[model samples]
Target: MADSDMGELAPSSSMDRRDPDLYIEDGNIVLSAKDNENNTVYFRVHKSTLVKNSPEAFGNMFSVPTPPNMDQYDGVPLVQMPDDAKSLRDFLTILYDPQCIATILKAEDFPKMLRPVELARKYQVDWICKLVASQLQSSWPDSLFQWNIVAREEGDIRAWDAYRTEAPEGDMDEPRGLRCLPEPVSSIILARQCDVPAILPVAFLHLLRFPSEIYDYNEVFPWQIPERSLLSQQDWARLVLARERITRWFTQEGPQPWKDCGTSGMQCQVITLTTWLNIAQEVAVDGNILKLYGRQVKGDICDKCKQKLEDRFYHLSVQFFRNLKHFFQLDE
Candidate 1:
């Protein structure tokens, strides 16, 4: 038959018409079209039929769901453990297993895991504690004693002697702890170590000192401060003075690269100033007592009633009293 005529034949008729040498192999229809030329044509069953009819055929192929690409997920792709809590837990686990401490310490950017270091100290992981203390001493010579206290408190005593040995002499009475520890780190330590209330004021002070460090100010100190805890007028004035001092310092110092220091750093200073201003306004009361004096001096004339002078203080102060009452209600 002509080559074009082959198209007219049904698949089964064409298969039967092929040379007797034609056969099926591995589920594929293989037909020898020309003996001397060794020309052959092969066709496989439809993919849908193969999957439906033969379980063995599908077994060779993996059917896993595709994993999502890095961009598909949110936030930082690296630094695998999520947030401070997970990082702390993982760090504590590693510290408890001494064998892992050396490996973790050697990792790149190891200091970024300071939370874990603090956690290790808290949990009393000896090896991790020593490693942290050693690293801190080498990196922050000034903070060695402070870090030692951290280590000691955390129960890592192996490096306590090393801490003492390396402690700088002179002014031993002076506190030598981590002066530059960030507010978040300080708050974490306080929450872990001390009562929340005692530490709260300190934490709030830290927030005031380093407003940029706190991400959620509303969460930390809700907008509606308790009436009883509100600063007294005098204290509010003092806070305003302190804010002015900080602002003056910043103004004189010519704006200390606050913008480059990151949002938390900048916000810390802002929150302190803003909070002081807010509290000052909240407590300030206008003490001016309004007086209505008629052209004719009559001490007994009822200021509000304007009828005649009366002996009652209310009568003398009636106009001022009514105004005061209105002011108080508006203030509330």
Candidate 2:
């Protein structure tokens, strides 16, 4: 708890019992929300802690106004939150638990932090939003080499390894963020909603690597309602342009056989180039590039040629990403 003995809400609500998971036996305030199962979940917490974390959101609410019209159950004031019980629980976990943020930062699943982030923004809780944004911003690779690695490694890479994934675990300069969730398109939609702009470019790129089947049907995503309206017109346009640009890059000026190969035969270079070109073409058409390929190169090619190939690919990929950003008016 950030603050203690600061103030208290009305006590002992028979109608508002303490939540076993969130109740700090002697805490001052009780927060409650209805769960999906239609049960009221209560949280016993300190008003001071909430106030300290989000002054604009909670401070005024907790204060004694000129004429207080408070909501109470069984004599104890109850704060009604708009979020579902699960999201509220996760939001509180981030606020109170020291290890929760660390867990969120490292989790392979992006949805783990999605609900919490939504609640944070809904309530105008700036700190949590900023924390999430920071994690997301740090996840993007700054250098060409790093970007290349991320393009190949995709979701499994650390947010920062050499700012990509292979960097030492102890490195502190780059923290990671959640990878594309549901799919890259969904992840971009989530990012746009959350106001995290840095994630857009890479997310768009990842989305390009998939098939339209993932985005064409509204039922595929749980969010869309009666209308089939997931992506915006601009988003669809960006996807089309990105595909055209990448297709041209692959077919017209694809990776050439690197001359650095020594022990590995030229046949291996051909296979690797062919694979890379295929992925580019597939990505343009919304094909499953990931399913067709994995990170492992095995012993098929020599290390030097592989490095050269990746380096070359990195140059073209970065250029394509920049061009795509321009097409979407996201470069700014």
Candidate 3:
């Protein structure tokens, strides 16, 4: 049947009904009221008309129960629709109906469906994650399986390394943080904490590796190093070079101005350390070492040195794992 024809027969009372207690006033549906001898007669105009014309008012008026005569009724609590219940009903109804389900199943626009799936994947609840997984399993099983395997393996490696390094010396009995959880679990934790879309692979990499290096390398690097340890020596060296390049960029052009001085030397040092720590944390969390290090000092000269801080500083910092390593070593 045609959509309009199908719409005509739908069971929505508001769609079929007319405004009963309202009248047209200046082309607008408005409530009509009369003051009786000792009471107020309050009645709505064409409620359905109001609903169609002024949905906000229509929603407000019929939202609760009232005495038969509007005049007889004193002010009372407005009727309210239970949003959660309505949502549950709508979801279940749409999900269970064969026609609706089939229509969704036949939809060729995968990207449109991707939005909701991504939302479900980001939901904090485990059941929601499972529901998303199940949907993916039924619709795009292969991709879902691949994501699961990769996420799980990566999650496991991260968890093991984190446990070995960050887990307190005598506190093995405590529950693991999100880092040690399954990928989906870790993703949910991160999504909840950060309030973002489903954690992409790159984002996962950043979260797992970069931020720790920024904050306290001695504490976080040991865990990340294990993942690098598996790489061939050549690959490791290349990775180090890439990291150096990024670190140089971050120091030079990153949001924090390294040259700015607060009132006290200690305060300046604290601010610098804290800023670098935060940058490192973000880089680690995103799992993109290159991004963490990619930021370069912005202007031509180090505001302090007046001489151009050469691009070579980028590689040098990586070699020493310190900012402005060349200047400091020369000073010493």
Candidate 4:
């Protein structure tokens, strides 16, 4: 009933130091930070827009009669929010404008997207949570090339090329012929947090490329990682162990020379074979056998062994991927 009895509230901070992009001059509600230095950080947003996206949460808020002598800034109702200003602003910004995160595949601000997910889940805003989750999920497909192929097969060729062409350009080296989440680690964190299972294998596979130190570090990650976004010990173990098993299997499969047909004297060169092995290992780590075969088929193999080797590699990879579910314990 009193401030002294309510215990310590979490400290408030802003997502942006300067004015947040969402601060409208004539808005209906004021989401004030819990701290005393109030207007230093706040959001001015329309009540109807918030209510539309989050009917249950906002409906309940408006249903209750206004309390006496409640704080109001410039005739707008001031609602105290325990969330830091930045997260609240980002969440409200998306609610006011649905397209805020639509075209951006890479995480311009991962936590900006993630905060909405946390808040959406907290407030039982399923649509808002699903919007953020889908945005996060779009970064990683079940199979990158397979994703394109499926799109094309489904008669959406335009979307296939658009997604392919939309690859984020920068110093980041993405998987060959595949689209990847801008920040795999952050996406993995979001996937687990939101219970978006379809994207987990891809996220975990991409994380294998990172060094072990990246997981638990306190410093800011490149993807704007939220504070203490560590995976459970079981998940970390599962990812690491899966990477090792996949790598080992591919390496062993790599060195074997292809079977010969007497008519054609085509043989893989030692260096070329090594490169093929490396590509196989990469594809296995990436969780796509078809991509591995696609890369291999592009090489200079003679006609006699081409189809045979392709069949062999396909069977091996499919078998491996089948076992992968067991390795990752996906069945459970």
Candidate 1 per-residue lDDT over residues 123-208, each given as its tens digit: 44444455644443333213223333432332333334345446786423433342232333333233333222223322222223
Q: Which predicted model would earn the best TM-score?
A: 4
Model 4 Cα displacement at 124 (Å)? 2.9
The positional error of residue 278 in candidate 2, measured at the CA in angstroms, is 6.8
lDDT for 161 (candidate 2): 34
lDDT: worst 10-residue window of model 4: 217-226
Per-residue lDDT of 2-92 in model 4, one digit per residue for the tens?
A: 2343332222345323236666778877776532345346567788777777788888887788765556654566677888766776667
Better structure of 1 and 2 per TM-score: 2
Q: Of 3 and 4, which scores higher on TM-score?
A: 4
Residue-wise C-alpha lDDT for candidate 3, range 155-179, written one tens digit per residue: 5555556786776777765334322
Which residue runs of candidate 4 sit more than 4 Å off their true CA positions?
1-25, 34-40, 105-112, 133-139, 143-182, 193-195, 210-234, 248-291, 294-310
- The weakest ten consecutive residues by lDDT in model 3 span 72-81
Against the reference, the lDDT scores of all candidates come to: 0.33, 0.59, 0.35, 0.58
In lDDT terms, how accurate is model 2? Answer: 0.59
Runs with alpha carbons beyond 4 Å of true place in candidate 2: 1-18, 66-69, 151-190, 193-195, 211-241, 244-283, 286-315, 327-332
What is candidate 1's local distance difference test score?
A: 0.33
TM-score versus the correct structure, for each prediction: 0.19, 0.59, 0.21, 0.61
Best by lDDT: 2
User: Per-residue CA lDDT of candidate 2, range 1-332, in tens?
Assistant: 11123223443333534566787766776788777776677887778778887777788787765234456543455677777888988888777884777766654245576777787777677766666666665665544455655544443333233353455666555435423333355456556766787778766655555444554433222221211155678777877776675566556656665556767667777777776766665556752222332244434777776666656555555565556565445776
- Cα RMSD of all models vs. native, in order, equals 27.9, 10.9, 21.8, 8.8
